[model samples]
Target: MLRELPRIFVNIAGYRDTELPWTIKDLFEKARHPERVFAGICRQYAPGEDDDAAPDGVFAEQCRVYDVHAKDSLGVCWARHQTQKLWRGEEYAFQIDSHMRFVVDWDEVLLDMLGECDSARPVLTTYPVPYTPPDKLDSPVLPVMFARFFDNDDIVSFGSRISLPEDAPEKPQPSAFVAAGFLFGPSKLIADVPYDPRIYFQGEETNLAVRLWTHGWDFFTPNKVVCYHDFSKRPERPRHWEDKVDWRRLNTVSKTRLHHLLGMEKNGDPEALKGIENFGLGARRTLAEYEAFSGIDYKRRLINGKPGRIADLPAGSPERKADRKRRFTFIKESNGWGCEETASGGGSTMAQTEAIRRDLPGVFDSLNIRILGDAGCGDLNWISHITGGLQAYLGFDIVDSLINEAREKFYDRRNHFFSQVDIVIDALPECDAIICRDCLTHLDHQEILPALKLFKESGSRYLFATTHFLGKNTEIKTGGWFPIDLTAAPFNLPKPLITISEEAPNSTKSLGAWKISDLL
Candidate 1:
């Protein structure tokens, strides 16, 4: 008896993309078993206006396209759902965007990579390296996705880093997240964990990754580049957001539904979250198990420090301690942390710093903060906007150059002063409130407690600082970045006396007011 070769069902969601026909051609030409390969594309195009070309010729016999007018199309997830409905029980399913270039024998490559995985069931996915149209690749390397940070919506934004020496250990590596642009897995995913059409755009990967993991499916990244994706969005290509006037409302509803599904919020739009129970988590694995493996606490909206990567040594490590002490000095001299407008991060931008600007003045007045100690002050871009009423604004930072520059720039305000001081080691000047923002996030897990202790002992009546509301306080190297949830375990901080949203509309970033005595 002869064994039958496995068949693959390629699921494509194309919207006004002119490269769809070429992508299909490349896929068929590059596959080892083009005859056995099948495709289901949900082509969302403006019938008479779109530049998209249909896939025809010999490959058309093996491919199916479900046409939906671009103006009527809801979003990518909706189109992908339509594509899933076209699945014809193939042995495997490969999901990809409409613009892509494939390697020769890519089907064989994916099958081999899948075989190399240790899991009984594995899905290969990644943010493939970018390629210019008409075939241009720049030393394509295997890439792995990592958690960049939680955005204002508390959504997990991802960042990709290249995995070097692509030739080594020609096996799939375990991944905590999935890429929506390219995912290849068992055909059962179509029936077991179908794409939720209600999810519009932003949180598609996160939603799919969680549901797949809970359904007993493991994720891995291909060790070698199997395909190249066109990452650049051409201005000519029409997008749903650009065409639809209500895109913002659709996105909000989608995020609300996702927030409910992830257990982040109990209450959301009833209409949007309706029928979500049908797409709830699978019984094969609990959501908690998925969280444990992925290092993402869904309810808390926290990401573990080392999801899959190694961290610097523990807080007690002499090297880490030394690095913590010298980090700011080096950053100032070397301009290590780059920002165009302000040397501080994007959080220090005008829009991001709006919360502090709008609410801090009121808090200062309420607390009668006559002498304000601005610890870890960088550039004084945002804070400079609100230093008028204070009797004394003493800005302290480890960066000597910043202090010198600040001293020169704000010389007109005799009440305003700049000094070089390390709050962790140096004695802080007495003040009514010690305003520390955007500092603790970069410190080691253990260093934060001592810094907090120093702040309390400084005789500052109130501590106004940045407190990430929905994140796990993960251990990290002293100078590395991670959100700090002061109320969570280890920190065990009591509720803040007054909490002002630093970033609004479900954003976890906030400035919390804590009476120094309460911190005791």
Candidate 2:
């Protein structure tokens, strides 16, 4: 960074090591202006090593080295605190690991690239394509463009990259996983979402992502390569987990802190909650909104654009289903998820809710009802009529735009509320009866069964779902009401009460109803 930029101050946080000053001395002399570069280092000295071991010279003018007693070493967080305390409020900042190499003009290019962002508060990061075998510096690899997710024992998520894009754009791609090794953004933003001293290391990235996103900060990957990380010397470097203590036990404690902040560990995890009490969420959005926007359901550790839960992918050969998310494919080909509903189109919801209010008093007046894949409360008023006498009512949908609109237009928080989509993975609050509209038909067959099983497991004694199964032989057209067989694989609903021949509501062309006991 010093070689590339004329006025960049470097913060080299060293813990349990004595080589930081020696390393900074070399870089300080090589930098364009030695006075501009400030090194805030936390060094642990050997027993006989002198505190002023760093030779006083021109480079010493810009160094603020801390003598953290070697015997007092606790974790990397303590070292980080010492390093960050040297902050004098610069405009922009870049946090990187000690072992890394940079491309030519990286600093200048990165600063200019920040101007290409679409958001007022943008953070630039990525798992930069590897640059290995120092001798083979010319070998080119593109930055990770696409994000793929996998769960980490419900602790957090793991991200993998798709093949590099052939034709890359000049601007950075918006990213959800904040690469801790390489992050570039405004100094205040970093200060706002600073590292938590309680968390050692395992869950720092996730914690940063949640805090930044909720604070209305957006993240993106630099289309151009800013720098490359050298992974060859990981063992040679000092790590927080290297101490003699039970690191595994510490990691378990860290996971609890992560789950609590994400709102996943609801029952208990008070210790975790207290760890993050000082670092609160920003005013821009909620964690659920962040999950919906990024398409990474933290509760489920699943992502968008993959054949995962809640992704309504199509039925075909594995070739078509591979690496594709149902919602992305549909929205790409058509206007959007074909589930948009207005008052006129959702007339059936009125009829259905009224029937429940009139025909099923014992169930409607006392039981809690959860409507999955509730597109929009097109029948909000009518549904409220039935739910008014009921114990409670909750509606959830995948399309967040519709959910947000419906939540604002109708439903009081005291009794009736709607939330984000979590169909196939995260368990919903238990309900007495689940009133699912024609939503099953929208899911990939692989997801339908798990979804049904999850709904049944929600303590729902009765299931009144209107989605249907195709007959023995039939070709189904997608993007509208299509052939979705709920009885096919995992879910074998005995048979519908009666296959309603009547034309269905907006999201679907036709539909039917099924009961919970029938499915069992």
Candidate 3:
């Protein structure tokens, strides 16, 4: 049964010029049995010459890397093809991007979830609610959602509810298909049900969801194990609406193709796809400006060698490096976590409440508790509650009340709060061990060294964090600020403390525990 457990396969379709994120590298490091996981690099349509390079360093240690060459038109199709060619006999299969941040034993969780499923069932996922959302429409946010296709009303209340039926056959219906990051049945299921090659851009997953529903295959959601994409950073607004319009047009075309193929047009009426047509005027305006200003030759560029899409770049270019640095510092100072001087402030009170709540008996049994920053009276309340004695203290800044308040209103207080790198670091307490649950990648490159220094000074014998490498190419934001090119770099932080465990899935409640003496 153990041997038959599905191998973890990561599909990086456009990871050619893009460096894997540190969070992903951490996954490789934390894997309980790294050998069991397999990483497949789909470099098929990268415009430039074949670098044929393997992700170097630790990732190279335990992963079987494959470089598959294909084209953008066959993006998802190629990925599905590779899954079939490899991992055919595994117990379960998962598809995730190279930038996902994880805090638990994902493999075991996936295996357990797959085991719970009847072999005949299908599994899909929704985007992990971002740890943070942008303040406004023009903020530097990741375009994680294809807002064009999703009905705002439908997504507003979307939560643990599995809108798609578990046993419903593949049929055309109003379904909110969980796109991009998700796990499904055995690799053979996807291999047999390959993504429609006709989809040149997005909407493939939506189409697949519809197809699966029509086929009577059931879908499942664990609602427990959770992971997040690197969508915390927002992008600058495009100078011209045409850039936005052109992308919207392309999205429209994809959606049109999907609707037509699915026979979603009512009474054979083409107007059923009117939602797509309505956006035409706006799309045309944006495209016109985009073509005139950017001079983008869509055809030649269609086959162009840009490693990943333009959207992957940071908000600004080289000139904005200083601004990025300033923002990073501001984020660290404002939203990061820290110990309260007194338990009187709202921060202290909140910490006290969480510490008291989480310290319940048997709570720390499976979970590890390491507080960063200073050990304040409020933080000590939590330390005393959790079973394992305060193990480590990795100091970071404190959370900004404004950000915390915004988070509370917008996100689930339980999951989203801790996911915030800025907030978590701010609330850290002094201890012997440091536990960073996929929180390190959000730090600026410059802050990493100082943060590490603080961790070392906090009397912490062990430090747990994640990192990725920096790629050569860079992205620029419209605001004229350019942060480090994260997509191009994989994380590269050294583990000074005891290497207790490799990658293991963690519960949304708690990740794992570490002994302070282990590092000594």
Candidate 4:
């Protein structure tokens, strides 16, 4: 790796312990270009007669060491300062935790993987597979993790224990979040987006991911394991958070400021930051595009990534499992149709939802549709169906609270309107085409045909609805979740222009394509 890049600037910060010395020495020795290592360290060694002294003059001009007193208590504050101080003329830079085990030629592995990147700006990072001390068992075979957003915007990753895909993981499979412990990228990227000195440690990854993404850069993990991290925290070793006066409050404030910086609403937009001192987002992409690509809605604190927990929902019993085909539908469901923060949907809208999501975007691409309404009755996947090229998009839900939240979250979108409108009570304004899917099943038996007629009147010639034939279930419980049969109604029921039952994967729910003229 030292051969690949001319010089490497190493920033060793925070109360460094005894192992940091051995780790630093190994870094220089193992490298093909040890002369290229320019380490800037800030440390306070524990007092002891047997403790080794600083190797300041020993390495000559190679390393620059700073001895901060043990009482100084320098936490992540050393990140920006030490990096700037140590940054010599280097082509690339990497930020890694001191307590890590690197494979032989790990530097070469990282540099080669990073060089394979097709992008001008690239980052290779992951929460590396773990390793134990020499006394324990060998490291387990683990694949490169494809991560998902876990509880409360935190990240939890999972991958097969078997065959791992060997390819350019970044461009093909972008990361939803990055590991702060192992971030590798270009030197200019690090300089352009420096670590926020004001930022506490808790939400560092979240802040970095957003700032980097908006700045037109991307992150990916290498195909193979280059390093292993020992997560075992030693009780004898002191921690910075343990010393902070009130770290919880400080962390909350940092995350809150992040909310304002990223244009999210969970923290209620303390102040919409134009740009903070020397740090802020670039003009490469919108946060919404990032949210769509990542399946994360920051304002709602919801994660809906492609391979996220939402997609990895648990399967059913053997008999039920065979019929279950994993499907994705992009319906902007209304409020109260809550999603499990840890899992996807409840196995209802898979087939139809995904079908509409995959197809409807193309519908607009071909036909010059004027408007689309993703009524507030289903999932928020519809938002991903479109980002541009639409004249206007009316995204509404039945619940007022969801509408308000969606308002704040999607406020940056142009011609993307949201409101709380019950189609049963208030008529949805007319549009060139209307998309209402996976929601009709939840209405009362008497309310189905009227809603169909309303959609037909509003959309004119084009309409798309994912429906269940009441003919299949043959049962009606007044107002329930199950679909009530429309054909068997006592009175003359309003019929769709053309209703054709089609089989699909994922859900047992059948799909039907509708046209307003055929139904009316």
Among all candidates shown, the one with the greatest lDDT: 1
Winning model by TM-score = 1
lDDT, candidates in the order shown: 0.81, 0.56, 0.39, 0.56
Ranking by TM-score: 1, 2, 4, 3
Indicate whether candidate 1 or candidate 2 has the larger TM-score. 1
- What TM-score number comes out for model 1? 0.60
Candidate 2: residue 7 Cα off by (Å): 5.7
By lDDT, is 1 or 3 better? 1
Cα deviation of 55 in candidate 1 (Å)? 2.1
lDDT by residue (tens digit), candidate 2, 406-505: 6776646566677765465546666666666555555545545567777767765566665444533132222234555555444556666544343434
What lDDT does candidate 4 reach at residue 64?
Answer: 70
Q: Across residues 156-267, which tens digit of lDDT does each residue of candidate 3 receive?
A: 1111332223433332222234455654455644544555443434555545554554444445544343455555432221111112224334444555556454334333
* Candidates ranked by lDDT: 1, 2, 4, 3
lDDT tens per residue, model 4, 274-369: 235467777898888878886776665565633332213322222112111111111112112334430123433444345445555666666567
